[model samples]
Target chain A: MERWIISFCIIAIEVWGAVYFFDIFMERKRKGWLDKGRYMILYLATVLVALLDMYQDTMVIKVLVAVLELMAFCAVFYKAELKQCIFFSMLNYSLLFLTDIFSLLIENILNSKDELYALENPFWLVPMKMVRVFLLIVLRWIWKGKNSYGALSYKEWRKFGMVPVFTFVSMLVMYFCYSGEKKVQAAYLFLSAGLIAMNFLVMVLMQDILEKGELLRESALTDQKKESQLSHYRDMQALYERQGRKMHDYKNQIRTIQVLLKEGDTQAAAGLAERLTESIFVEMSAVNTNHAVVNAVLNQKFHVARGQGISMIFRVGDMSGMRLDGEETVILLSNLLDNAIHECVKVAGLGRKAVINIKLVEEGGKLIFSVKNPVAKKVQVADSIVLDSGGGMHGVGLMNVKAVVDKYGGDFAISCDQEKFQAVVML
Target chain B: MKIAICDDREDDRGALKALLEAYGQDFEIREYGSGESLCKDMDYIRECGIVFLDINMDGMDGLEVARQIKSECPKVHIVLVTAYVNYALDGYKVKASRFLLKDDLEQTLQECMDDILREILQEERVMEFGFVEGNVRLKVDDIIYIETNKHKNVFYTQEQTFNIYKKMDELEEDLKEMGFVRIHQSFLINMKYIERISSYVMVLTTGKEISVPKSRYSEVKRQYTLFKGVE
Candidate 1:
């Protein structure tokens, strides 16, 4: 096993170098390189090697490495645009299978190590290696154009991958038959074919399923974040609005006091109105929240509720001491409210109107927030991203909710019965 | 000062109300929801020395209302308010006091209102006419030919051509004297900027060639001619 480490290290370096060299070329070729993570996988190849080696020789290490490889496998499978995955992850894999064939051939031809060395001589691989590199360059062209870098279904992977798997298996079986190594030839062939097929098939299916699970976990998190942001924005909006209303209120009070003084009741009403204005000022200043844009968005959302004739109540929490920035607060609140408002506005046909209730409270080391609106229609779960598992304005605002939830240590969930569309999040 | 307003759209009527509240304040404001609203009630608008009416409306248009107002309420001044300026020539028939564009509300409206009020409301002065030296000593209204050369405003009347150094926009502003508008960036002729406008070319009155920018073609024509309907 230790003797294999040197070759593994050399292969690891070669694979990583080629991957990064291509990555640099891609980055130089495209402007939207940050959002385009096609080249990012090449870097991840290095990460895979190091991550796999983090725990070595133990079953736990083996499992962890396999899991890491599985993640990379999922990335390669789903990211269909970078068609170079075969030349990259499965790089020496095909060659190793071919070597299995060659080793059998040499064992029959000559018993010495020199014959094996001749087979591995790099000069002998002109056609195969050239085909691989040419394929890589073509795939790079596809990746550079960034056309559907990752949107492959399990079916698509199987369709494209069958030829390589069959060729490799044929060569391996021929080698095994020649090497006199058939124990359960039928079972071996079945299991080998099945394992390879399942490796590709199950990986795609599980990647889709796991990505969805991670997505759900993520969405649950962002839902909570969105709630917190909604409350934060709402609280800030309420503060600003109250301050604005106070200006009108305080001015009228002063006018009343002046009238009272003019009417010779200066001793009576002036004191009372003056005290009232002071109390109003105290209330306004106490709500010294830190956000203007979020306040505006929440205020607009509230106005939307008003225009829709829905009874939307906001329970604004004290977000003054909290650390969510203004822009994030705005984005989260806007998206959450937009989704909730859409649902709220849809609440009809039940011979009843809609009601949207927002509550924000901090409890037990978590920011607990809830937005419950009566939905007229039954809630249906959205379509899962079977191929491109990460994002888009897909299925629901679940991706957005998940992204934001993951930002903060939070949780998001929605339970919709016939009458109520309820979403609760904790951050 | 008195001014009458006419429009046919409920939303446009509301928008005009808001615009007037924001811009027009001085003269006692008379808002007629339609031309007939004021046409049926001309006696009510008789004191409104200036009439502002729209070209396209559900009922009677500004032209009919203006013709009627000129005959029925003789002393009441007529100012045409329209999205299209081509109504200006029809305005000449009823002796319209001024042409105000509704689209250019802030600058054009403010200036037009000021001019209308100055000449008719306070009754301080009337329209300013220009004198161009030529064989006939033509008034600016008669001589529709003015050409620009290097930095000078060259005059081409029915009889003579004289050059003067004046930029187009400035000259157009000053030529409130002769009701001149900056129709083209380079040419500032009086309401007489076009010789003949067609599917392609706008032949200038001066025999000079100019491209009528698509955005300004309808506006310039409406401001200068009667515009019965589009060709």
Candidate 2:
């Protein structure tokens, strides 16, 4: 009964350790203790795995069952792709096998006893279990905050999944071949330790590569967005030039109207004047903020907003005090307005004419820039940080804005309610 | 409403006056040929609700006059009128409420006037509440947010907090049309004072932070966004 209790305790710790290991790397599908059903299933699975470990003498069969149970638990509990769940399950089982081997090797070295005898003795088993749990905890601590697992694609997972599959197969083969031996050698223990270390290094390197890839992709997308915005600005400039030509024609038309008035053709003069005024008013109203870059970005975004059936209102005040240069202004304003436009476009429907309000004003020696737009969904913010809703470039755009704001030693803030989202930057 | 139109050219001033009259609103219109003359009449500058200044005036340009008037009476809305759009940056520097192209005056003046009138009306709105001390009149714009504490609803403004025996639902119903948003059950915030809303918390212009419940977050945000767009 005592031995059964110890085995259950060891299995409980091992199951919990695996859960902790995967939990660090992957996001939970549902959080909090309120998820009692999933938690109950997980607990029952762990107990079943513990009972199987006691009844089953074959190490390979026991590990396989435990791994399958873990994979099942992960599938139900984690918000990850199928490939990721499988890879994490396999990797976790391999690590558990390695720690078990390490603990057995240590016990053998301390007692100089046969491996079977070390396994059967309660004195050896309890300390070995403690050592195994300790190693697992240390390994978990190393990967505590790294959660780049979700970013890995299926292809990447397949490539990285090879390491653990190889390790698991090799460890099982080694255990089967060497378990029949009288005593475990110290050299074999060193080999298993080296294998464990290699696994740790590979995972750390994989996470680093994944993070760097994500950064590269985000920056590349930002560059592409900037290129598109600049082209949009050029198109707006062409439109402005066309308007300038029209203005010249209006001048001639004015001259004609004045000539008509001089000729006492009052009716014809008024008719021409009315036509000119109407045509000019029908043209796109140019947003003229004396700052050339600000005017370009705002006008381009305004045109884009209008194209999407959304209205953009600008309430700009003294921009001379704004510390941003041409490039910074374009990045900051375009990203902000683009984010606003993106959100507004989502909710622009019948009876709801989405509107974006862009405000740039200098107050009390600080340049305050803000954008407000109607939100169709709830925005999650935790501890003042805006959490990305995922699946869109909105988060990346805001990050770029935040980067520019930070570069200028400015304050960037985001606030949202059920209907609206607002981003504010103070420089 | 008292309207001041300052332009160096008499023709532009007369044209603006004609447009103002055509709008059919009761406007006490005053015209100045130059920025200097407009600046000289401090009493008129202080009393007027809106000032239309021409940016290309000969002596003391519109931007300079706007800066002076803004310094003297910050409440007065200055609309900068310029033939060239390039002077818009300078207009922003003087904190002009609106910038109108001299060429597009006929098209934009009515819209500009409507916006200014709405703002002026919002600013002038006042409500009297029975406080613990007595009935006190409060400018609707001055109340930043209202918080329900126990049986009393506390009104927070920039200067002071007024504790009154009032229901939040009743106040929300009354102030619904006046730019006040019910962000939370306990908090009815004035949209004018909202600096930003982040992480389910509303931060005011005066740096007071109020927590917004997750369920009502999206609705509150939408209302705030609409309020800002209208403003």
Candidate 3:
């Protein structure tokens, strides 16, 4: 009974750690009602699965139980779509399967009497649990979350799926070989270990490749943003200069009128005044965001939004203490505001009144940026995977913004209903 | 002195020619209404000590024309004449000897002509650096900025960009006397190329924007204004 309890505890801890690692990696969102009692159910469910695996001793039944547990966890807690859930399920099971197989191989390789006795001892479970925990921690550290796995396209998903499928097949084959009646000799055992290490090495290398591809794409987007922002700044400067020139010309015209009045040429002075009023046009007031780069982005985006006939309301309060550098500031604001304006324009095209509300506030040492725009078109935002089929990767800008925010270790959230799409970033 | 006046507008060309003629300087003047004709007249450009290039010419605007002229004859002075006052900042990018506003031609024209003559008579400073192909020389006035990439420094002049394997500190020290300012870890810009300093951004004449840190903005601005004052 004591051994049974020890086995249950070991299996429970392993399940819990795996779930934690999956949550960190995939950033799954939990249903509101299931949030409080999900962990208790997870522990109970893991305990029951462990009992079934131990007593039944059927590989098929054990696999079925593990699949059911993962499905239940994903259905109850995770808000991913069917495809994403399946992908993550395959990932989670493959990892757990590899770890279990690795432990068994280690046991088979060290087949001395003392080693066998140590494996049976309940105290030995602690080191086993520790090894699993350490491995999961390192895996999480290596898996950076800037380029979200959940947001990959179908082609990318297929490429990523190959690694897990390979791991599963290799680890399952090794497990069957070791578990067979044929005595596992040292030569075969060492070869199996070598194969498993190679499997892991392939996984790591694939992840590195994915990471580098994402980084290259991100930097390319950033370069594009920089180019646009430079043009935007120049446009804003040109507009301001035009306004200044008008003012300067007005002053000169006023001086000419004064000289004409002094010589009592009232007719010429009146005509000049008429011409001045005729050339006068409205120019929008400048936006001052305390930061020049942010100001330029806002001013330029506002001009664009206005040109699209979308009403824009901005309430900026004290952004001096924000930590973003000039390039990041330009990229973040322009991308966010540009996305918001695009969405607003879509609503306007549908004959609906479009409005964009932007607010920046500093609270508790965090700079909170929120942009809300109405959307007439449909948008599906599951966790962070925002998708719009009509827009064709329109969410790229927001993802880029999220990447910048993540670089600062900041918080970002996206929520949208049928009427409105809202994004909040805190840094 | 030999002078060339290039403007797409015949009236602008005539007006500038009349202004130069009224200046009472011993200058032989030629006029071209389009940049193509002016560029085609390489012999004229070689003989001409100064060119009054209109910024808004139809084909080959002033900036591109100035780039071509400066690359061909580094010693020749190019003065940008424009109705737009904002082109003053853009003038520095191509190392324009001076800028003359069409609106205030009576006052600005004489002043611009005097500055152009002074700059033409002054000795030019050129900096040489080695690249993959060979050693290249750049007139310090023609260079807008030098930026550091991952493994090399890119020297940006009006006409061309040269990649050189050199440290930023060494280049900074070398260009210090030539009025280059280190505004960021990765950026060293020629003070002469600065068109405007608005907020914390230094807008270069080449239309490139460089960010200035808040803590150092005032000092950079002060140094830039002092440099302008000295000029």
Candidate 4:
């Protein structure tokens, strides 16, 4: 009866350790924890299975129960896509499975040496049980806070040394189980511990590399954005210089007109004025926002809107005090206005002429930017990018605006209904 | 009122003198044929209520003369007179009160002097703030931005920086009308000073780069756009 009680108590302790470690591994809180009743039910069931396995003395039942427990744990605790949850659960269970194998191997080694004498001795189980508890506690501590298991992509999770570590631990477990000599058992246990430690080190290294990769990707994206903005600025500069030359020519033409007037050639002066105005028609299209870059972008967008037969109402309030990188300003305005124009164009077929209203204003020390356009069809937010029925990567322009807005620590709000879509960015 | 007209060409100065005289305004008008002579007569330049400076001058340009006159007497209004309208933008950088094209000399000059006369009769738009040495008065137009460095609030202009002991919020209230924006915790930039902004960085007219916090970037950009847009 005492021996049965001792085994039952050990089963309870083992189940408790597994449940506690699972909570830490998944970064679940103890108080106000998710699905508390389910966890309790699972814990009771796991303990029952463990107790039954101990009585039946079957290794198959033990492994099967562990896998079932893992599935239940993942379902109740993990909030992620089914595939990602399963992947995370597999990682957690693999460690638990290896710990079980190590415990079983220690027991087998002792039993072989003393003809099942050590099995009867309660003291002989101390080292094996201690190792299990120590491994769990260390794992719980290492994965104490929220592990970013959900954030990682499938490729990242796979490439981050999970498969190799699992294989290495499995091979060590097999070797330890087979090597049952008295002296070799302790050595095998230490070797397995060393290998597990090395696996953890590799995990840390993989995480670091993953973070660095993400950083590099982000910087590269910014660089690409900067390049595009600069090209736009260059295009605008060329146009501006051309306009400047025309302005100079207009002055010289005025001088010619003055000379013609002095020579009593009023008809010739009138003809020159008409020709001069016609020649500078393109130059007259340029928006005067006081900032050259903004003026260029606005003019470009204006021409685009005009080409599409979309009525573009672009109003810019005092922006002289504002200075933004030519590239960034171009990217932000071009993308935003482009998106607005694209939406307006899509809905043009819906009987009404498309129109977009863009306002760049300041109030309360904040620059208020707002763009409004009628929606062509239903809008869907996919991958955090707002998309209309007129699909493709058309939403990329708005996404670029969002990226720039986010970088500048600005507020970007989008309000879309069946009829109208408005995006406001306040910096 | 004392008026100083500095032009490199004798004919241009004579034309300016004739125009100012035709306006029939009772004033003492001093003409400098070159920027060097205008800069040399510091006493007359200091005492003048308004200075009409020709931009293209030999032996020190009008911009340099204006800079020297500004440092000595910031209260004195400097009007940039040039043939090219394009040069008006450059004139604005130096805080020139008005840009008068030589072609419309009489009308532009009369308008500028009339505005100055009205301002003289009204309140001065100068903001006086306490600095390290003492209280210094600055024309609202001359200020580029006010920034916080450690504990000091540094006022940036086109030519110089003035360090003062003042809170950002307090200074903001006083300078908001003058088109100053607080871009970051440590930065209150004059919207006029912004030459370029991208990502988290803003380039001032002086070629100094200012880091903008991501959270306040849109705010800074919007404010700047509005300031530039309205005028």
Q: List candidate 4 segments past 4 Å from native.
A: A1-79, A111-209, A248-293, A300-311, A320-331, A334-359, A363-366, A370-409, A413-424, B1-231
Error of 1 at B136 (Å): 99
CA lDDT, candidate 2, residue B38: 88
Q: How does each model score on TM-score? A: 0.30, 0.53, 0.45, 0.46
- Residue-wise C-alpha lDDT for candidate 3, range A107-200, written one tens digit per residue: 6455543132246455666576676677677766766644354335677667766866666566555655554332553544555456545545
What residue runs in model 3 are displaced by over 4 Å at the alpha carbon? A1-44, A50-58, A70-154, A163-195, A217-225, A244-281, A284-333, A344-376, A381-415, A421-427, B1-231
- Per-prediction DockQ comes to 0.00, 0.11, 0.01, 0.02
Report the lDDT of model 1 for residue A98. 41
lDDT of 1 by residue, A1-427 (tens): 6435544444444444354434522223222344256445544654566566655645334433433453354344333234334522342344333433343343334433323223444433333233334434443443333223233455555554664455555644553343333434334434444443443443344345545655665676567556656665665677678778888877888888888888999777868775885566334432112335544565566556656765443334444454556645555566667777877666643456555655444433455556667777656532212112332323435556545555885555555567765565556
Q: What's the CA error at residue A408 for candidate 3, in Å?
A: 9.8
Query: In model 3, what are the clashing residue pairs, if there are any?
Result: none
Report the TM-score measured on chain A for model 1: 0.40
lDDT by residue for model 4 over B1-231, one digit each (tens)?
899999988899999988888888888999888888888899988888889999877789988888888888988888888754444445655767666657556434554566567655333468787888688888776787777889988887777889988888888887755677888777788776677677679988778998887557756765665454322
A95: Cα error in model 3, Å: 6.0
TM-score of chain B of each: 0.49, 0.94, 0.54, 0.54
Best candidate, lDDT: 2
Can you write out model 2's per-residue Cα lDDT over B65-102, one digit (the tens) per residue?
99999999999999888765555566777878877767
Span of 10 residues, lowest total lDDT, candidate 3 chain A: A111-120
Q: Pick the candidate with the highest TM-score.
A: 2
Tens digits of per-residue lDDT for model 4 on A1-427?
Answer: 8666666566555656656655654544222334566446665777677666767755545655666666666665554445445554555555554565566546766566523223656644545556667876776556433454423555665665466446445644554365546666666556555555655565456556656655755676676577667758666776778778888988999999999999999999999987776556444545455777777777777667767776544345556766557776887777777778887888877776576656665544666677777888757643335744433233346666767777877656665678776677667
**Docking level of model 4:** incorrect
